[model samples]
Target: MNPCDTMLADDEAVIRALLNEVPFNGWTRTALRRALAACNRDPDDAAFLFPGGAADMIETWACLADRDMEAAALAADLAAYRTPARVRAIISLRFEQNRPHRDAIRRAIAVLALPQNAKRAATITARTVDSIWHAAGDRSADFAWYTKRALLGGVYTSTLLFWLRDTSDTDEDTIAFLDRRLNNVATIGKTRKAITDKRPKLRIPMPGFMRTWAERA
Candidate 1:
C-alpha cells in the first residue's frame, strides 16, 4: 500500500468518526479528539492529520463527498440524460449522499460562513461545482467552462440552503426548487444566445486566474 493512500484512509477513518460527533460538539478540537479516540488513532495525531483544525476537517469531508458524488454519477449512467437533467441528477445525488450528515453539513456551512474562513469556503464551493460539471460530462475548455461552473455554483448553493431547511418528504420540495432554478438558467442561456446570434462574434480569452484554476481542475 502506498503511503499517500494509507494517509488518506487514515484521514477518512478519523473524519468519519468526527462526523458522528459533529452534531453534538460542532467542529471543535474537542470533538476531533474524541473522533481520534473512536478511530483508535493517537489523540496527538489530530494536529498532524488536520493542522488547520476544524476547517481542514470540514474541507476533507467535503472532498470525500465530492468523490462520492462523482462515483454516484458514473454509476447512474448520467450520459443517458441531457446536460440540464444530468446536472439535476448529480445535484440530487449529492443531497442523497449527504442526507445522513445533514446536521454536520449545517454545522459546516456555519463554520465556512465565518469571516476568517471565506477563502476556504470559496475554494470548496468552486471545487464542488467543478466536480458536478465534470461528472455531468462537461469537457468544455472555453469561457463557457467558467460560466457553467459559476451558474451551477449559484444553483447548488441556493438549493443547499433550501435543503437544510426543507421538511418535505424525500426532499420533494428541494428537487422542485432545483429544477426551477435550472430551468431559469436554461431560459436565460437561450435568450442570451438568441441575442448574441444577431451581433458580431467576439472571442473572450479566459482570464489568467481562471486558466490557472482550470489547469488545477
Candidate 2:
C-alpha cells in the first residue's frame, strides 16, 4: 500500500479507538491519550496525529464516517433509485453506521458547536453533504451542484439533530422526519423548475457573490 494510505489507516485506527473514550472523556487530550494507549501506540503520538487537538480528532472521525457512508451507498447500488431516494438512503446509511458510536457523535457535536470551531464545523458539514451527493450519483457541475448540496446540508443537519433526540423504534421517527424534509426540498425544486420552464428569461445565472460563497463552503 501507499505510505500515505498506510498513514491514514493508522490514523483511522487511533480515531476508532478514540471513539471508545470520547463518550466518557468528551474528546479531551486525556481521552486521546487513553485511546493511543488502548491501540498500543505511544501516548505522545497524539500531538503528531491530531495537532488541532480534540477538534481535529472530531473532524477526522467525521471524515472517516463520511467515507464509510459513501462506500456503503456505492455497495448498495443506489443507481436504481430516484435521486431523492438515493440521497435518503445515503443519509440513512450514515445514521445506521454511526449508531454504535452515537454517544461519541454527540460529544463530537458538542465540541464542534463551540464558537471557535465554527469554521471547522462548516467544513465538515460541507464535505459530508458533498459526499452524500456524489454517492447518490449526482454529477452536476452547474449552479445546481451548489444549490443541491446547500439544500441537502440543511436537511442533513436538521435530520441529524432530530435523530439525536429521537427515541422511536429503529429510528423510524428519524427516517420519517428525513423523508418529510426530502419531500419538502423536492417540492420546492419542482416548483422552481416549473417557474423556470414557464419563464425562460427568469432562469438567471447564479450570482457571483453566491458562487464565491458556495466555493468557500
Candidate 3:
C-alpha cells in the first residue's frame, strides 16, 4: 500500500490525515509569510531557516523584488535557486524597464524607417505588453506578475484538455487560415500594381481643329 494509504487505513491515523492535501485555508500563505519575515529580519538565520531547495528559490525571488540585483544574481547562479517563480520576480518588476533597458531596445529599432515595419511592430508590441502589465496593477508588490507567471502552467494544462476534447485537427485549421490570408494579400498587391500601371491618361483638344475651322470660315 502507498504510505499515504497505509496511514489512512485507520480513522485515527493522524500522520496520514493531511499529507499531500492542498492547503486552501490560508495556512500555507501565513506560514510562508512568517518564514520569509524571519529570514529577512536575520541574515544569519537564512542558513538554518532556508535549508531546503524551496526556501532557496523563495529567498532568491525576495532578493530580486528588493532590487538587490547583486544578491539576486548570486542566488540565481546557484542551481537550487532556479525555478519558474524566479522568472516571475523579474516580470513583476515590470513597472517598465529601467531607462537603460528601454534605451537599448529603442536604439536597436532606430535604424528602421519611422511609421513603417519596425515602428508598427514596436507600437503593437508595447500595446500588447501594457495589457499584460495591467493584469497585475491592482496587487501590492506586483502580485499580478506572479499570478501571470503562474498562468503559464495553466496554458499547457488547458491545451492538453483542448486536444483531448477536439475532434478535428485544430492545427490544420490554423494553418489553412494563415495560408488563405497570405494568398489573398499577395494577390491584392499584384492586382493593384497591374491596374495602376495600365490606367490611361485623359486626352486634350487639338489646336489644329480651331485653326482649320477659321480657314474654312
Candidate 4:
C-alpha cells in the first residue's frame, strides 16, 4: 500500500514497525511529525516520504479518527459511546501538542484511572482533555461524562490552537476562553437539572457573514 494513503491503523502499525526496526528518533522522527502535520491540509507537500508518487495520508488519518471513534464507541470493551465532539477534541489536541502521554487521559476523566506520572504536565489543569474516550472498568461513561469530557478537550485545544496562532502575550484571551467554557459546562447540567429538561439554544454571537464563514471553515 502507498505509505501516503495508509490509514491511521496502517500508519500506527508502520510507525510501530519502524520504531522496532531502529531507534525512532533524531531528524527522521522530527520529519515524520512534520509530515503528519502537513499531510492533512497539504498531502502532496510530504509526498516524498511515501513510496508512490501520489498518496494522501491525512485523509486516512481523518479516516482513522472516524474509524477508531466508531470502533470504540460501538465496542463493548469500551465503557460507553464517546461522543464525536470528544473525538474531534482528542484529535485536535493531539495535533496541537505533537505528542501526548496516555496518563494525561486520566486527569480529564474521573472514572478512568491513570498512572501517577501520566498527567504531570507543569501547571496543567484538570480540563485539558488527554483522551477522546469514555471511562472504562466498572461503570458507564454516559452523557454527563461525554459532555464534560468534550468540554475539557474542546476548550483546551481551541484555547491552545488560537493561543499558538495568536501573537499576544500571557495568552490572556485563551485563559479567558477556558474560564468561560469551564463556567458554562460546570453550570449546564446543574441548571438543566433545575429546569428539568429545558433545552438550551446555543447562541451564535457572530454576525451572519461570520457565522457562515465559521461553518465553511
**Best of the candidates, lDDT:** 1
lDDT of 1 by residue, 1-217 (tens): 2222234777788888999999999998888989999998788776666777788888888888888899999999978799999999999999988888899999999999999999999999998998899999999976567777788899999999999999886888999999999998998889867755765556546469867877865
Candidate 3: tens digits of C-alpha lDDT, residues 45-110: 334432332322222222232233323434444334333333333232332222223322222233
For model 3, what is the alpha-carbon lDDT of residue 9?
22
| Candidate 3, superposed: residue stretches over 4 Å from native | 1-122, 125-170, 200-217
Local accuracy of candidate 2 as per-residue lDDT tens digits, 1-217 = 1222234777888888988998898898888899999989999877676777787777788788888999999899988899888999999999988887888888888888999999989988998998899899889877678778889999999999999998875889999999999999999899978866766577667568877865775
Stretches > 4 Å off in candidate 1: 1-7, 201-217
Model 1 error, position 5 (Å):
10
Report lDDT per candidate.
Answer: 0.86, 0.85, 0.33, 0.40
Q: Give the TM-score of candidate 3.
A: 0.19
State the lDDT at 215 in candidate 1. Answer: 81
Ranking by lDDT: 1, 2, 4, 3
Which segments of model 4 are wrong by more than 4 Å? 1-56, 59-96, 99-139, 149-161, 168-173, 196-217
Clashes of 2: 0
lDDT at 74 for candidate 1? 97
Q: How many clashing residue pairs, candidate 4?
A: 1
Candidate 3, residue 207: Cα displacement in angstroms equals 32
Q: Estimate each model's TM-score.
A: 0.88, 0.89, 0.19, 0.32
Q: Model 1, residue 66: displacement in angstroms?
A: 0.2
Q: lDDT tens digits, residues 112-169, model 4?
A: 2235424432113232242244322213343345445546655654555455544444
Deviation in Å, model 2, residue 120 alpha carbon: 0.8
Model 4 vs. true fold: TM: 0.32
